[model samples]
Target: MIWDLFVLIFYFLVVFYFGFHFAKNTQKEDDFYLAKKEIHWVFLLLSLVATETSSLTFLSIPSLSYKGDFRFLEIAIGYIFGRTIVALFLLPSYFSGNTISVYEYVGNRFGKSPQKTLSFVFTISRLLGDGIRLYVSSLPIAFLMERMGISISPEILGIIALSILSFVTIIYSVFGGFRAIVFTDVLQWIIYIFGGIFALGLIVNQIGTTTLLEQIQHLETLGKWKVFVFDYNQTGDNSYFILFAIIGGAFISIGSHGTDLMLVQRVIATKNLVSGQKILIGSGIVVFFQFLLFLCIGSLLYVFYEGKSIPPDKVFSHFIISEVPSPFLGILVAAILASAMSTLSSTINSLSLTWARDWEMDKWFSPRILSLFFGVLLFFASLIPYFLVETWEKGILEMGLTIFSYTLGPSIAVFFLAKDKQNLPISGFVFSLFFLFSIVITVAIGIGWKLSFTLLVPIGFGCLYGLVSLSRFLKKN
Candidate 1:
């Protein structure tokens, strides 16, 4: 236990050192938010991966495979396709101007009213979505503390864990800004990937390679290895039907990668358009492989436990606490922290940047102060999940994705409208947003209809686009 604590302390110190080191160079607005537009492609690529990975990816992805099969990969395939579209179609407009907020593209076309409206929606959705992410990140920490014989209630422990993470993430984000985040993200990426590899190695060592192969073969007999879903009948009941998964995944990627400022900021930070495009497309491929690694880890865990029943969300963390050795256990915990903090810091910085640029909050406060403020807001937001845990039944990944789906579709729809040669009417844009939200809210509350969370983005995109187009046609006639 002492050695484990030492490892964690050391990790924190190293991250802190990087934060303060970058603070000296972050003297300007561009330096703070866009990293002076000087970051290398490799760093940007890894940072983009780390920011999106979150603890949700580290924890919840394996759970998906543990509970089901590899059908989730279909969504990942869709991610690649979606990013490719962003690179080809949407990115050109972003690069055409020197605007700070991506919504400025909308502002330039339609007006500031729609631009700020989209930014506001993005801010709210990002906060709620990442609040859930913050809560999910705290779970392993709380679980680890409990295993270490801490006598506190899990709820209090979760808050403590969340506070510690938020503080460390806020410090660097406030001081070092986006550059610091990109650098630390590279480090965090290494730690978590290594941790995943280490865990996989140990599992293989215990199972014996030959027996592992035999066991996998046996598991395959039970359809555990199934990946593609071809049956259309399963569309309503299954989220991973290949067609739905791919289309939904693609739209989700478009919303997340193309429109969300958290990621768009990364693309904007790259040295040039080509560099940005490289990382955007490359990240999808890297993520597909990353998901495969974790999914395989979950499948093997299933084999290791001889198919014993375990809650999918708890499977990986439970295994680490029960089976992993001491110093390595601490290292894996740090790995989880690495994943969590990377996303948290990025969230703080992006939220700060968006508020400062989009809402003109910089006039009232410095960027660092805004960073501090949002960090506090996010910490409080993250705490809400603890009270609602009994009611929210979806896994962390699905819930986080659902929260994102709410605003992502409308946001992406606006961007699609912005790309057209004809300018969309502000009234039409406003009406479409209303229509999109009403349907999503109704579907979300389980009011007389059922839909897979995956379908939300496409539904939102179609609704918003269709309404805006109709309004445009009426105006033309």
Candidate 2:
């Protein structure tokens, strides 16, 4: 208990220092928003890397790898296709706006309704995402400890850990702004990718040099990394599912990079379009390997727990609890904090930026006042950790990502068609509205209908016709 509590105290002190350290750098709204567009490709790469590898993925990848090394390879194949599309289409769209709220571009292309509607979706979706991660991250760690005879309530630990962590993140974010978020994330990213890899190496060394290679061979023999679907003829999980993973991965990448404000906000800090593109392309490359590295760690865990009784999510935790030495435990905690900080800081900063600009609340209150307003709201909001956990477990997470199909898809479609052109007619809203309505109806009918037809049927036909007519009408001019 003392060792663990000491670690917690140490984390709070360090994180608080970074938060206050960066607070001075954030002066104007621009600094708060995009770090004054002063970020470099290296940091941007790290920031992007850390953001994509959330704690959930960190916890589960190893779990899946441990349970069946094959699953790691299977799922990572989907990420490859997703990252490819993100590098190509999504990166460009974000720079086109280079402004607050990626959805503002939707308003420019489509209309006001689409922009407001999409922002609401992004905000709510992001809350669910950040909330879910914030609530659950500490729980997994606590569970691992109890198995080692360290009794602790996950619920209590989650609140305590999250509150302090969230407070630390909120400093750079809510107070210092994007500079604090991205720059600190760049620094912290080192502890994670490197520390995680080093831990894997230590474990491998402990097992024998061939341990990793043997596991990979074992996983391959079981067909773990196969790209095609599990049950091809099921119609639901058919061969075409890879196509879905690929296509959906492509579109979803755009939805996140192009539409989601958290990521889009990060790109605005680039030196220019060229630098931004460099970061995107560079980060995409890093992600391919990063996923492999973590998944390898997971696969090794799969080998480690060949006959043990433990949850898949608990594999990495088990390793940390039982294997990691004390001095380096602080190092591991640093990695965990880095992962947690990357997500929390980005979310809080983005949330503050959204409120200040979109609500035009800035006109009424000073930045200090606005920051206080957001801090109070989020602090109270964090109290309902159960709702976040329930929503995440109940599939609200994937749905939140799915909802982006409405705003981001049309925005990209419009951008593709509307380049070097004048204002789109008010009828552009018709297409946007169609996409929104289709997604809403699909979500309302429930997840199955969404998976089946929400996107492909209505918005597909509606946007095709809208763009075709739009092109003809432009030619007549």
Candidate 3:
């Protein structure tokens, strides 16, 4: 037990030291935000993949497959197509000029009003969404502590985990800037993926490959390997119809990668647009295979447990605590932390950069102070999930998506309108405003409308596009 704790602490110390070591290289704002525009596409690609695949995905994806099947992989296919569109179309606009923030395009097209609004929206969405992510990541730690004979409650354990995660991540991110974030993210990407592979190897070794394959084949006979959903009404979170999945997937990709500053920063850091394109598209492929490996692991767990009842999110963590032994167990926990800190560190840095760059703070300590401020905010925000655990019965993945859906549609719509230089009207703004309010209505008022959260992105974009067309028609007449 002491050795396992040492391994975990050693990983944190190494990451912190790297961050401190790289801080000396960042001499100015450009280096801090863009890594001096010298980051290679491979590191950027790995960082991008690692950022999106947060601890939430690491811990929750297996639960998704255990509770469901491979239907979620369809969204991944859409992810590839959507990123291709971003690479071919949206990225050109960003590269056409020196864009420090993705929202700069909005400011140049519409005005400060829309640009600031979208940035605010991005900050809020990231805070809530990643807060939920922080909470989900702590679950495995909580389980581990209990296994080691710790008597703390789950909520306290969660808080302890978040505090430790925030402290370690922020220590490096504050000093190391973009270079540190990218390099650490690459390392984290490897650790977590290796954790998944190690877990699978353990399973295969225990049961023998042939027996595992036989069990997986049996599950396939029971339709557990199913990937596509045809019916519209039947589709819910993690499952989608063909058309809706593609459309939703594309729009969400645009909203996230195309507009969200956290990801856009990575792309803009590359030497050229071509490099950006390669990284963007390559991440899609990597994520597809990554999801498949985790889902297959879930299937193996299902068979190993002989179909015993387990909570959806707890499946993987329970396995780690009850089954995984010694140093490997420590490695798996480190993987989960890596999944978390990569995303959290990137987010904190982005938030600070957006404030410093967009808000025009020239002081050297502006980004650092902002990083500390946001890190603290995120730590407290993470506590919300622990309190809501009983009330929020949906799986962690769905919870994260649901929070994103509230603002993502409007955010995406405004970007599309800005791309065409369309003059957004007051009504258009109202329509965008409704997108945020509708979530409250759905939850609080129980409105008759039953639209799935997955479809919100396309619907938001379609509405804004229609408004833009209508305004142009009236002016022409």
TM, every model? 0.96, 0.81, 0.93
Ranking by TM-score: 1, 3, 2
lDDT string for model 2 (238-273, tens) is 213555544554555555665567776766567776
Give the Cα lDDT of each candidate.
Answer: 0.85, 0.60, 0.80
When 1 and 2 are scored with TM-score, the better candidate is: 1
Each prediction's RMSD over C-alphas, in Å, is 1.8, 4.5, 2.5
How many angstroms is residue 44 displaced in model 2 relative to the true structure, after the best TM-score fit? 1.9
Choose 2 or 3, whichever is better by lDDT.
3
lDDT of 1: 0.85
Q: How far out, in Å, is residue 410 in model 3?
A: 1.9
**Model 3, TM vs. native:** 0.93
Per-residue CA lDDT of model 1 for 1-477, tens digit only, reads 777788989999999998999999877788999977888989999999999999888888888878788888999999999999999999988999998779777777876677777777777777787888888888877887888799999899999989988888889889888899999999999999999999999999999999998989987987778889998764456678788899999999999999999998999888778988999999999999999999999888888876488888889988887898899988999999999899989989988888888788888898899999999999998987778766877887888887787677878878887888876554646754654564465356432455677787887777777777777788888
Write candidate 3's Cα lDDT for 1-477 as tens digits.
787798898999889887988989875778888888888899999999999999888888887778777877888888888899889888888888887888877777766666666777788889999999988888888877887788998778877777888888888988898899999999999999999999988877887888887887888897889998876664443237777777777777877888889988888889898999998999889999998999888877778777588887888888887889888888999999999999999999898887776665545566678888888888888888867777875787878876776566667767666677546555534544544454344333222444655676766656555655666688688
On TM-score, the leading prediction is: 1
Off by over 4 Å in 2: 1-11, 68-98, 144-152, 210-216, 225-231, 235-240, 366-435, 444-446, 449-477
